[model samples]
Target: MKKLVSLLWAVTLLAALALSACSSNQATEALTGGDENLSLDKEFGGFGGGDESPGFGDPELMNDSPEDAQVSDVIADEPAVIDAMSSDSPVKAFFLRITWGLLEGDSSATEVIDWSGSAEVSRGTLLVLRTIRFEGNDFVHLPRDSRQKVEFTSQTKRHFDGLLLAIIDNDTTASDTDATDGTFTFVAGSFSKVLNFSELDSLDLLEPVGDMGNEVSIVTRAKDIVPFAGGFFAGRWVKTRRDGGEFKGRWINSLGTNTGFLRGIWGINRFGNKVFKGKYISANGEFRGLLAGQWTFTRGDRAGVFEGRWVNRQHKTVGRLKGHFRTGRAGDRRGHFEGRYRVTHRENAEGSDS
Candidate 1:
């Protein structure tokens, strides 16, 4: 009887040990994705996990490690997170109509032309305006009886002394026809003009053109200049890993006054390229705009160069940015960057009037 009892106890002890071993194996598999060679210790070490793990601060982690290269390859195969342009909607814009003869080189004259015909102007007709000398174009949608304003860049105002505005009817089945075209000098104080379509040879035909009217009204205005410094910018950046980082810097004008501050983020995309984006605000925190660009670095290198453009909220390229950065220690998150920026002027920057 004593021998039988001992045998029963031995069986129970063996069964409990087997059950515990199975549970332990399952938990290990769950943590290591069932890979016999991989472990939580190895993976976490690369990210500063354990005392035995070599952190990113180690130059070997960036250069000689096959594991790091494999990780980069995996990331490069992923899809992009950010596109070149953030928005695609049409910007708010205004329209202006000025008569033919009244635009004749007079800066201060305010003569309105009278027409007898009450022709109706259709919506969706394209109005094309350009400077004869400068290489910029403005396309506006025509709305009946509405006075709209035109925007000119400081560069356009300084370079092009004259303006030519034209109306075109775009036809899908036929060639586009010109309804009216006029040339006039742009004066600063005068924003309103009466454009007479009757003066155009296209409007003089006996046959009524596609939505061609006897007259239309147009106006032109200059954008208010906001005083800000433009020149070189210098700043520092830091990252927890190759995939995410932040940077901050100061920009100055030609006079070397600390005009504004810039702060933004940097990251490595799926393609393995380093991309960064940020915004600049005036010292008073009043004026603000966006900037974006990429970093060019060689494999295994601790330093690299970068270049990109700065744009307004409208996504118009207003300035340029270029700089370089250097990493500190094997786990250091800090780096430095410096670059220059220049703001460009435009008469009609791409954006909505709203």
Candidate 2:
């Protein structure tokens, strides 16, 4: 009976070992596709077609790491993006123009005073007034064909105060009734609007034209709505330097969009005199002219001013330029210059100073 019990125990042991060996071979075959040459690491590396292999104790499917979670949280905390071209952006410059219009009055003595000009008001602020008519009349009559243009810049913390008008009339008698039918165009930064005199009342208010949201306010009175007879312009000297420096700026015309660009170089000659020379290129770069000017130092060469003339290829003067500049330090190569350029002779082209 003892020998039979030992035999049974031995057989059971052998069966258990055989079953374990079979299970191990099946697992290896599943991992390596029955390729004995393939190592466990190489089989695992190709698992799921991924370059990496899971560690012995790692989870089959991984979650995002702590660093990835932190990055996602940071992204969620960011503020919404703002549009750069939105109306809320600050305006840098502006141009306004009044086309042909007429002012009618009850009596023959009704007069129309027409004028257009540009001015530099307050540092860095350019005010251009094209043909704006202030008439001593009762009503404005605008024809269907007339048009106008207006533009201006906006400040972050400041508002446009008002326009200053100086009406000079030498004759007492009323001038021949100026044409009354016209329109006006206004531009403030990216905001632009064209309004006819007929669409406006004696006192019209124009605002919120470009989704500006109360940022701009324009009031039109009866007398201020006459046709533009002449040309007026104003622009800032964007960049100017004295004593061997570059001179560059934009010249806005009465029509508002007929912009011209001036680029030149200035330096002191062997005689110690400051001189500048450059060219005036139209906005489209089709028209061009020559510019030459002299710089006169007022503050002992530290701060000074300049004046010059722009001429056609024939050497005939078409406009005048005058501006002031001040260097931050003694012997500094660059200076802050601001001035005005007036067109004396109108050119034939569209961008030739109106």
Candidate 3:
């Protein structure tokens, strides 16, 4: 890590501005005090010049008066780090593995999305991307519902200035075969909620990422993404039975990353994500019809999991569910989940159809 920082400092000094970031504070718990967290703010006072960069810290770090800056100053000085990512030459890249969860209009309905790309950050502008390999309009793991509607081919013009005003075509265009727009909100693991044009445009830009790595990710504001986020994911489910039969399913409302209602499952309880309250209808085919119960599945980006059991509307346990969950931020339930479970039917099962 020290070697990387030295290399970065060496390279940065030559490019435009000379940066002198103080050595990162090593973790107090470690014997060597190696900086496990690598908290940058305390390291360099927000990446500004420190005592190391000659003629750089005159005004800020050294607390030199105006006269000193004038005497030693040769030309106008640039910031220590401008757009830490997304530069024309070599911008920083944060390798994030985001497993997007959901995309409902709600702020909590974030889906599990794996992020594996870089955010080319520069001074004030931030550009993030995850290469989505195209396979007949579908990218890896990005369920059909999560794909954006806009397209970005060579012809499509993607736009971004600084804040979340970036643009994708809004309509599906001749887009690049693969792409994933970063809408980084909250912090590292916890991504922003699913948003649309209106929802996103109204939002403020999220804070920049701290450390850049596999654990890092960013979500683009819904408005900025509309122009180039590209592609579309319609919601539909197909369950293949052990026998030669399959029942098609779809959500009454789009189930996003966090919480949303599910519908049309031949056998199951209510919308079992977070709220875990919805109805289960019985289909006539190979699918056995079942009555409604209390069931929900809430996913967290980094830590929470709404698992355990299926319950009735009265909150009585009817069945059990087991799933794995991860954290997004400090708060539990702010992350996402994936799991499997079964529901128990009452002796006198009353069924209905919607």
Among all candidates shown, the one with the greatest TM-score: 2
For residues 1-354, write the lDDT of model 3, one tens digit per residue. 999999998887865442222211211112112423312112111111111222222232122111100111111122422222212313222222222223111244333233222222111222213222212322222121222221121100111111111222222332456254433222213333343333332222222222221121122222211111111111212212210001112111000111111221211212222222122222221112222222222322222223333334344444443333322322121222233333343432232222
Worst 10 residues of 1 by lDDT: 64-73
lDDT by residue for model 2 over 1-354, one digit each (tens)?
999999999999999999987855654444333645432223112112111221111231111001100111121122321111112423222222222111111122233222122222221222232222222331122211211211222222111222321111111233348334234444434444555544422222323323222222233322111122122222222222223444344544323333445444455543556666656665445444566778765655444567777666566767666655434332222233434455566552223333
Measured with C-alpha atoms, the lDDT of residue 143 in candidate 1 is 29
Give the Cα-based TM-score of candidate 3 against the true structure. Answer: 0.20
**lDDT of prediction 3:** 0.24
| Backbone atom clashes (below 3 Å) for every candidate | 24, 29, 72
Best by lDDT: 1
TM-score of each: 0.33, 0.34, 0.20
Better of 2 and 3 by lDDT: 2
| Candidate 2 vs. true structure, TM-score | 0.34
Candidates 1 and 2 compared: the better one by lDDT is 1
Question: Which window of 10 residues has the lowest lDDT sum in candidate 3?
Answer: 154-163
List the candidate numbers ranked by TM-score, top first: 2, 1, 3
Regions more than 4 Å wrong, model 1: 1-229, 298-300, 330-333, 346-354
lDDT of 3 at 80: 26
